[model samples]
Target: MKHILALLFLTAASVMANTAHAENIGCVSTTWRVVNNDKVCVQSFKDPDIEGVACHVSYAQTGGISGALGFAEDPSRFSISCRQAGPIVAKKPIPKKQEEVFTQRMSFLFKGLNVSRLVDTENNSLVYLIVSEKVIEGSPFNSISTVPLMPWGTQAPQFQLK
Candidate 1:
């Protein structure tokens, strides 16, 4: 029974691991703080479950003794932009409601950056929303970007909604 439980746990983890991951593209200095420098970090990520869409996010990162040590909680200020990178195709069904596509840790604990995706069937677009989350408090700040179904390399995507 223990081995079976472990296998189930591993399977669940592997399935959930399809979440999108970001690559650190660059950072720009924002302010010179004590013991370190505050800056904005730019990250790029591709949709893990969806094809032909890429997103770029820029957010502020606190820099100081605490931040340098990975203890500071990043502010809830970020911008997102997603564009069509290639021919969009989905063999499986996609959700019409918002679904989480990515999550990035901004602190040692209690804070993270998340991106969600929603297929706008009416508008024939894919919407991506980025937000910051805290364990105790909720954030109202978020950014959204959309990629409309359009021509790519002489072929247009036939969006299928389920």
Candidate 2:
């Protein structure tokens, strides 16, 4: 039964596309399993639409028979931190409202991890929020990070959202 479920999730993975592509930074094992080890992992991704900003997220990854086959539902246990890696620059149009910038699957179908960016015009900052979403239920597990658009060595770029 678990194998059947795992197969279904793997099939769905082929069809469902994740908007963000993250590079694994590292992982630390938490529990020992026969096939694999349950671990906490950190992954980093750059904002595709925006330049000079990068985010690193960490979350728990399940292990064991089910997890090894990519069938287990990962917990909505994650945190995010985004920073200005270089001089701030808006590569595309800045939206006035909150915009989803990244997404990763957390479960078979109904659950996912999402990241969004909001331009804080009043504060002259960019706020990034990460949330866990499920189709049938709401999750309170979420995190946020902010980056202030300031001068990097002599270049100060102020932004206006459209």
Candidate 3:
């Protein structure tokens, strides 16, 4: 029995360590409790790898072992928001379909929030998309923000496949 307990302890520790590392390298994970004390604000941050384009994402966390094992019956509920907190300059205008800049899991059951950056070529603007998803259904909670590329002399070149 002792051996079994020790092995389980080791396994749990390893899983937790990997989760922490995954959350740190390319993203930031944080937890904030809801005012009602029934849910937590779990957020993940992913900065655009491209220079001059900065993005941040925050989302809510709902269901977890706490609710499953600790007698907390209510699943966690969340809200998400994203913003371009800096000057928007593109080394090159990113493609519309290839615009998913960041993604993070919002729950253990395959729910997630994704942020994508789209180039509105006709309007000469940049559009940011924030969407929430789950395994069975997607949340209607979606938001969009746009930044119009100004009259700067540097024009974005059209993308072409080599």
Candidate 4:
């Protein structure tokens, strides 16, 4: 039973997770008391399975000695905005909705921020969502963005959605 629960937990955590690496854009000091001031920062990453779509996430990063040493738990306050970096190309078929497309650990353990994607076939757009959660608790703080599907080079995506 213990092994089964562990498997379920791991599976839930990584379901459809692309796990893209973040490229730090920059950071600004939000608090002056700490050496490493608590600051809101922006980072960019691209979808591994879907080419040409990139996302920019901004969140509050913990500061001070703990944050400097990577031992602080960041607050659940982040936003996501996905856009067409170049041409919209889905190497894999877009799902109606997936569990998660991106995830970033807020702390060292089971606490982190998660991003999921939804296909809006009616609007012909892709919607991305961000939610902060913990193993024992969850945050209501969340964000969303959408990218409409259109021709990149000369034609739109050739794939059909269900």
lDDT of each: 0.84, 0.83, 0.49, 0.82
Give the per-residue lDDT of model 1 (tens digit) for 45-145. 99887788999999999999988998998888899999999998765678788888887777775577889999887898899988887767869999999
Q: TM-score of each candidate?
A: 0.85, 0.85, 0.51, 0.85
Tens digits of per-residue lDDT, candidate 3, 25-139, equal: 2323243443323334434453343333444344443334454444333222333343444444444545566366665555543455666666677896667777776656877
RMSD to the true structure for each prediction, in A, is 4.5, 4.7, 9.1, 2.8
Clashes of each: 0, 0, 2, 0
Q: Higher TM-score: candidate 2 or 3?
A: 2
Worst 10 residues of 2 by lDDT: 11-20
Q: What C-alpha lDDT does candidate 1 achieve relative to the native structure?
A: 0.84
Over 4 Å off, model 4: 1-17
State the TM-score for model 4: 0.85
Stretches off by above 4 angstroms in model 3 are 1-49, 63-93, 151-162
lDDT of 1 at 155: 83
